[model samples]
Target: MDLRVAAAVSLLLALATTTGAVTFNATNTATGTIGGLRFDVAVGLDYANLVLSNASAFIWSSAFNQTRPADRKPVDAVTLVVAADVSGAAAFTAADVITLSAPYVGNYSGDVRTEVTGVLFHETTHVWQWDGQGHANGGLVEGVADFVRLKAGYAPAHWVKPGQGDRWDQGYDVTARFLDYCDSLKPGFVALLNAKMEDGYTDDFFAGILGKGVQQLWQDYKANYDA
Candidate 1:
């Protein structure tokens, strides 16, 4: 996808937030699949059902597409909604619903049946991810989501390049791109960072990865932007 188009999609989703409690059908069975990968979607609900269910799972699949087998199921059953215009995107505040753009679905050359599955992985991580009890940096929150997407090999073609964009924690694709740099220099770096976030988040967490603070990571990331 073109960067502009991807950015538009991201922005649309960002505005797609709702402020109501989520309701589920006790008998409501949902199945989710992406690029042909499937999984049990309801296993990790209620932990933070709003964040852990569908949204997080979709993002998770996107980030870790390469980590799963082609026939593997990522979630048991969730309604996969492919919207030509993201109309149903905002209808969900609870992460329990899997939503994807129509163009995104059509862009996959892989067996991935739907983009919603991939996007779920990223959102699912948010549900399960510890945010230092809301003290975590938003950029890192988004970056980690993309990090999962990067690791999963679903990163869009436009995401391959690095940059001295806004700030390191600029969130979403920008932060994800920087996280990719850290991962390149330090194997398992993203994993370690995720572990750290699980317990609690701190700026010093970067020290654990690069022997420097996150600010330093940002600087280093920018320095190598063109390399």
Candidate 2:
């Protein structure tokens, strides 16, 4: 993986992934490489688009609890790129685009489609979720995205067990586990918090949603699982 040159991009006229005005596109630049070949064999463009479309619907319905369009960031299209590069990670989303590391795809030993779909669920949350107008905690932002993935039933077995994080906003699976606990106390808790974040983020949002600060909730969350 010395250098990644953009492959001939095709604006895939997606299947039924598009709803009304929104469109989804994908391009596999590494199709000639081993990793890219695996991606095509395990997860093709049609399947990837399906995951992206279904993930978006899942986040809107479950993660946001059907929050109105005003609460959402308006992105009419999303593009996913499978590149011939070693990102040292699975995948990442910047704005409306998702980049999957072809090297990772090539090396996957198990259900690659499921794994990639799970990664899409998490990254798709980033595309839709607010970042507190760039005023939110990075950990919380990532945690919320992971929480969405968790709810989507895509949380990998390697994820930390519930109540195992060192802090409530520990980010990723750790914070995602904490958020799950908070959601249990008050259903739709995450949706409310995300709504509040549309303007800005504050720890007080926890108090407003669950009548307790995040720290106390985190402790209680841990105590429940301490067997």
Candidate 3:
């Protein structure tokens, strides 16, 4: 018998072949154009489609999809991994994630509709956001994501309160509110901050925007809010 065949026969005959294990790698298949970006979706996957589709829309709307000096591509090839149920919850990692709601057969509308669009606006910001080469503030990271959601016109209705949070970067809705306030003081403030973050992030960048350190700016923000 051939050496390979002999080895296989020995293994099959030994111990009645009781114990064994096998692993599978998921294959991704690309579908139709998603907001002008093509994607190879993972089979039997749910959330990745939702998130990547929304990111495509935001980039197109924001004009990031257009050719620019940055040479950033509208949609980076996405890798989808389903880990735990992330619906109605926050992501703990830097990777972009989405959890599917009931599949809407027709056009997306209403609250859940907006939440899908909004969360991706928030999450995909993580995908593209620069973090001072991994040295950015945690609060600022959360704030920037929420800020993108805010700008996307998908902020939750209850998110209108300007300033009532404990800290400046309380994350999510709270930090979003503070960013809105900062924008009121300086038009294009968030845009400027985002541009700065593209290169680096620090409290000094906040000072460049507000004429003071972020801590002092937070103090002023609180005083104004309290007034």
> Native-vs-model 3 lDDT?
0.53
Clashing pairs counted in every model: 48, 0, 0
lDDT of 1 by residue, 104-138 (tens): 43444553322333465465455444566567888
Model 3 agreement with the true structure over 92-205: per-residue lDDT tens digits: 334433333222212124444345446556766766555666577788778877877776666777774776788887887878778878887887777667667756767788
- Against the true structure, whose lDDT is highest? 2
lDDT (CA) per prediction = 0.51, 0.81, 0.53
**Model 3: residues with Cα > 4 Å off, grouped in runs:** 1-75, 79-110
What residue runs in model 1 are displaced by over 4 Å at the alpha carbon? 1-114
For 34-68, candidate 2 gives per-residue lDDT tens digits of: 99999998889987886777777677767886534
Candidate 2 has what TM-score? 0.89
Clashes of 3: 0
Models 1 onward score TM values of 0.54, 0.89, 0.60
* lDDT value, candidate 1, whole model: 0.51
* Ordered list by lDDT, greatest first: 2, 3, 1
Winner on TM-score (1 vs 2): 2
